[model samples]
Target: MSALAPDPRFVSQAPGPGQRSPFLRRLAHASEPWLYSAPALILIVAVMLVPLVLGISYAFRDVRLLNPFSGGYVGLQHFHELARDKAFWGALKNTLWWTGASVFLQFFLGLFLALLLDKPFYGRGIAQALCFLPWAVPSFLSGLNWAWLFNPVVGPLPHWMVSLGLMSQPENILSDPTLAMWGPIIANVWWGIPFFAITLLAALQSIPRDLYEAAAIDGAGGVQRFFSITLPFLAPTIAITVLLRTVWISNFADLIVVMTSGGPANRTQIVASYIFTQAFKKLDFGYASAVALVLLVLLLAYSMLIVLLRQSLLKKG
Candidate 1:
């Protein structure tokens, strides 16, 4: 009798080189994820990487805004100058306060809004739309509106404050250094709150109703359920949002630059405005670039800290 032929259908397939398993083989060739993200990666490289490289190059050289001169081989000069400059330090301090305070307030306010909106009510859609309107407004243009609204002489807010006997005179919020920082923050927060609210609201909606129902069956109240169940699930989202907002607020220059022009004695100038001033106004192109490099480094450090914190939290869970 002839040798029986093996059935191809039941044959053992040899493992391909570099493939851990058949599952990985499918994943290795999968087009869905890469296709979905290819555009974003290309866009980021073009928009983000190009500017980053330019900024870094300019930091090393004296490239004035007007002249755009290539200031060559300054070596630690700009960094040293930044360390000595009071304006830089002041701007940094204000930036930290602005970013921290605004993020904190935005988080709580967003959490409150998200919680409130999670419960269905009349006109909920309209209310949510109105709440998110500030985000839709152009940030720089919002600065203009806010600047006028905070104007000492004519803003309706100050008038109300005066009428309420909070102050005998309409205070120039943008003129006082302490209040000046707050002016930009108020605008930034208004724009930022809707972002958090929307993000958190989505997360809140995704929570299985069964969890809440089970909690209710266990005699846990809304607050209790939130503390135990809701907070735990939302922690990662909140952390990510806070870190993102920190990065954003730290770099936020629009409101301050537009509204106060880093005035009230450079009290409102963040790293962004400071870099702008160094590059444009002072014409210290290389020095400004160095300051920018420092800011970028600091931002990276901050992001690293957040990553560490996230890792620690994950380990705990």
Candidate 2:
């Protein structure tokens, strides 16, 4: 018998330049990012999303840790309780003050430091490192350190204030209900300023030098150049940084828990710490989850407002 002829249908054609096997290649290309990100996505779902959903469920049901049978559905009972919770209202007010003051101070101070660092000088790198050192310290340690520094018996700050006539005598400001919130606020600002500075400095460095040069050549002075060139360029960064820091600081409870534990008549009890207190100390997980849900809603609203405002401003400009 004659040798079987080569089967034309089974013959393969070599892929030319820019050619590829469509189906498999397209699938791999589409799935490549998901494959690389699956681990992180799974971790986030496990750690964050799952807890969030569970907490929302807990908000509507009794989930006290110490109770043997506390998972009964309660509908809007927890929310109704939250509405009348005087302590929760107080904590909400404190959260606003804490977040506003901390973000304002941190942003301005960071901007100042970033501007200073943006310009070359002696020991510039060292100065940047020193300024950023506080951020490197763990949050708990920073809180404790500041708590110590506010202690009248051990710290010199109160004594120095007395010497400068800023106080009647060496007194622990953290013990004063009126001034207690300032303790955590100051610590937060110090620790957070470096973050804003680093972010702003990076944004500042990315600005084209020629814009400043053009502004200067147009008879613009320092202030004019700043207003006309720098401020406009930095506006987006400032808005985003402020928004993020506001939300983060509003939710932060570590410094308050470490420094004062929301003491002094609960004057420093922001919503976050109050939630922690309800959950951990009182073991009222339902109430704590309710409070957290409220906070989450408020934060979502605030973020949306900021984003809309930014978009509007961008359009107007």
Candidate 3:
């Protein structure tokens, strides 16, 4: 029996001394990057992902803040109520208007400013800084400032409108249901335009100077060169910025909350402000979460649609 000599294959398969097994070595190699990133990953999971999951779960549960025993599961009852909520429907419509008008004004005005800033001029640096001043201001402060401007008592905007025949007389537009949404919309546009201006200016500067020069030499007009070269060069940037800004503006409640508090009979209540009202004012955390989830889904669908359209346009180009 002489130690029925160990098979050479088995001997070769086993790790010797303190050496790691092949499986362990492979796992260590694979996990090295994750080990380095563990802190950030853990922080994100704790701060963002955990809350997100909890919020989604709350959407299906009766998690009213006023009630101690309100954590019971309610399934889709909140959503069912949302379906019949006229206020929710109205807010959704207002959300569409708010997002569309704000994004449209911001992008075009910002593009114009970007184009103007891209050109060389004396005191251009000062001009650029002044143009971007609005964005540097906090949203809350901007909202307050704009609110005051819309006030007829101390602010001059209403008086100016009166002088220009845009208004019948000095009055607080924020108190008017027919015009209250415009108050926040104007404030948002002013605050958000600088974001587009900065991003679009960077993209504009990256375009080849020789392309514009060549177009000019070929007797192309400013409009022709812009449409043919500038716009084409800016298409991708425009698409992405528009999509992101649309989503952002849709979720933005700061201006409305500060300026109008979604007031004038909730006429200016956007979905985002409505969510705030439900969550903090009414303490209906479950219903608020449901509305938030619906908003998330809607934004996600919109983003996907925009991405698909961009891809198709790129393919065609």
Candidate 4:
């Protein structure tokens, strides 16, 4: 019999190149991610980037509120003013204290809480929820609540201090310039601790239980395991969280604004609160923008330094 002609449909054929145009395929592949991210990119540009650029521009121009002819090019005049302003220097110092103390206290307490929560325990879910509830409250509401708590008339804190012989009488610490800054710092720490706890708790959970088991089996102590394994794994998370929190706390003025309004004598006036006072109270948008720009530059420098330090430490390790 003659060889059966190969069925046309079933005949094996060499794979042809992709029928779609190569250029079209390449373009589509390259554009896929951008297409998915376009909405977010556009929103950021419109809301954040645009306002940032405008604010920067205002730094170089006179743009006072309620002034029809105020948008004049001023060229570093605001910076010159800021340099000579005593209040600005005071606020800068206050910002450092506020951010430093708040970040440190929050990080330590949060880490301790995270460690406690990492172990299995009854009612763990409820405990975690209760501890994290502070973060769920609005920042402004937290500020107001803390402010109320500091009131000698209606709050128990002052009375408790007096009863403990820590104070001569029940007094509002918020009115005492020397101690006023502490009030806001305390509030900030209380509100921020949950944030670090939640983040560190998640990081802690991600650690391999096997590592701890192995370390224990090798005769490692609890302290040793934490220092060697837990700490190393948590270093990155701690660094990032601390850096971001520092920046945020420096810019945070709500609690100060609501509690003390910059003080019995501007003792609690951080740069952020000062900026608010300028733009809203004094209606000097240009000056406020200039101050904001200076703060932004300082924060940027701080962030860069932190990143460099982290990279150097990582290299050393």
Candidate 5:
């Protein structure tokens, strides 16, 4: 009998001399993901990483905008000056107040609105749209609008405040050092509440209706269910949103710049506005970068703390 022909399927299909090596093939396969993400990685490096690095480097140099030849390395001189700078210290204080007040007001109001909108009601869609309208407005426009609203001569808000006995007369609160901070804070809260509302509303909708039903069957009241179930479910979302808003608000300066210009007596001058002042008005880019670096470090520390706390809470849970 003739020997059976070897099965082609079982035969070794070794690479020809012209074919790629196994290692080269594996390498190419491994690099596919990187190739796919190359555009995003490149964009991140160009937009975020490069600017971050340059800003850090600028902190150690004297980079005035007007002076082309002023790029000398100054080490920690800027930081030392920052340490002694009373204005910087004041601005830092204002930053804490501004961030705290705006975040607090925005979060609570947003949560309230979210809770309201979550219920089955008439025209809920329209109500939600109207509530979120302020957020859709550009921040610059919001600032300008709020500025106009607070204008004693042109706007009705000052007159309304006067008639409501909130003010003695029709006066621009933005011009009062004592009350100037509140103008921007109020505007920021108005613009930012929608962010929390949108996020919290989404989180609220994700909650299981069955859980609420179960709680009700177990004789839990509305408040009890909210505290025991709703809050716990929303905790993670709240933590993350609060952290993001805190960071964003800490860096926000548009309203202050457009409305008050950090003026009257620099009462509304947060660190972000201070950075702008140094960078543009003072033309001290190096110092501005140094301030920005400090802010970055502070925000990083804050974020790490929040993350660690959340992790601890999760572990305990």
Candidate 6:
């Protein structure tokens, strides 16, 4: 038999001066994009990669500003301490509550607002603005207002609620252990609604009016039109929004810090604030970093799960 043809590298397979291999040709034909996308790549590396490295560094070394040598290479001691921490578990649970409730409530309420506001009506613009008002307000500043509103007295809101019998005797919403956590959830939900509404409203507007009109002609009612045309089209946006907000709320420690300090007795502690308490309040940097690392792991796991679930559902659909 004739000897096997020489490999392409051994015998140059030059088609022409301008011609190239299929793979190389495709790559050459398409812009390499290194220079064009370099700025974004650098920015992502600088912002995300640097901070992540720092976070991991802090996790390993028991360093504090007071003493750089406060650092000790006590391998997995931090993780062990965090594993034994009651506060960490409590905080993790609260994080779940905040993220789960906030995302759910925000999506539905915002979708409702987007739908109603998308429709023709007098003063619709004003109504939309009002609905979005909470989002316009700064989060910490809004927390203060919510904090005051839930105060037992001195605030009009609780007093008015008592008079309206919506709550009994100027109820201190956050005074109770059970109610404190929900206050932040409620505040976050109110603040978050506009974001979802605005995102979804833009998507909703892009939808053709003809679809609705055609559905109506087919005798589908408002509810039917919504479920069929609106929801299927809007589902992807809703999923994206929920996933983003879930991740966002999962790390939220500010509102809890400002409003309750994780308290009425550590009742409202979340992993973020718990980490804060461990690091600064308790002076356990190594242990705190362990908790932080665990928190990061949980979020990473959840995010991966969500992506996989989304892909699976997309495939099935």
Q: All candidates' lDDT scores? A: 0.82, 0.90, 0.92, 0.90, 0.91, 0.81
Model 3 lDDT vs. the true structure?
Answer: 0.92
Better of 4 and 5 by lDDT: 5
TM-score of 1: 0.81
TM-score for each predicted model, relative to the true structure:
0.81, 0.88, 0.88, 0.88, 0.89, 0.81
Off by over 4 Å in 1: 1-47, 65-70, 305-317
lDDT of 4 by residue, 14-64 (tens): 224644444445568999999999999999999999999999999999998
Better of 3 and 4 by lDDT: 3
Ranked candidates (lDDT, high to low) = 3, 5, 4, 2, 1, 6
TM-score of decoy 5: 0.89
lDDT of 4: 0.90
Tens-place lDDT per residue, model 2, 189-271, is: 99999999999999899889999888888888999888888888998889877887788889999999999999899999999
Better of 5 and 6 by lDDT: 5
Clashes of each: 6, 0, 0, 0, 0, 0
lDDT string, candidate 6, 205-316, tens digits? 9889999999999999988998999999888778877887788888877787788888887888888888887777777666777778888887898799788877887787
Q: How much lDDT does candidate 2 score?
A: 0.90
What ranges in model 5 sit over 4 Å off?
Answer: 1-13, 16-20, 306-317
Clashing pairs in 2: none
Q: Give lDDT tens digits, candidate 1, residues 1-317.
A: 11334345422564556635544445666966898899999999999999889878866665555654454566666677778999888878888888888999899998999998999999999999999899999989989998889887668877887899976888878888667788888888888899999999998998888999998999999789989999998988898888878898788787877898899888888889888776667877677778888888988988888888878877986
Candidate 3: which stretches are off by over 4 Å?
1-28, 305-317
**How much lDDT does candidate 1 score?**
0.82
Candidate 1 clash pair list: 59-289, 61-71, 61-286, 62-71, 62-286, 63-285
lDDT by residue (36-131, candidate 3, tens digit) is: 999999999999999999999999999989899899999999999999999999999999999999999999999999999999999999999999
TM-score attained by model 2: 0.88
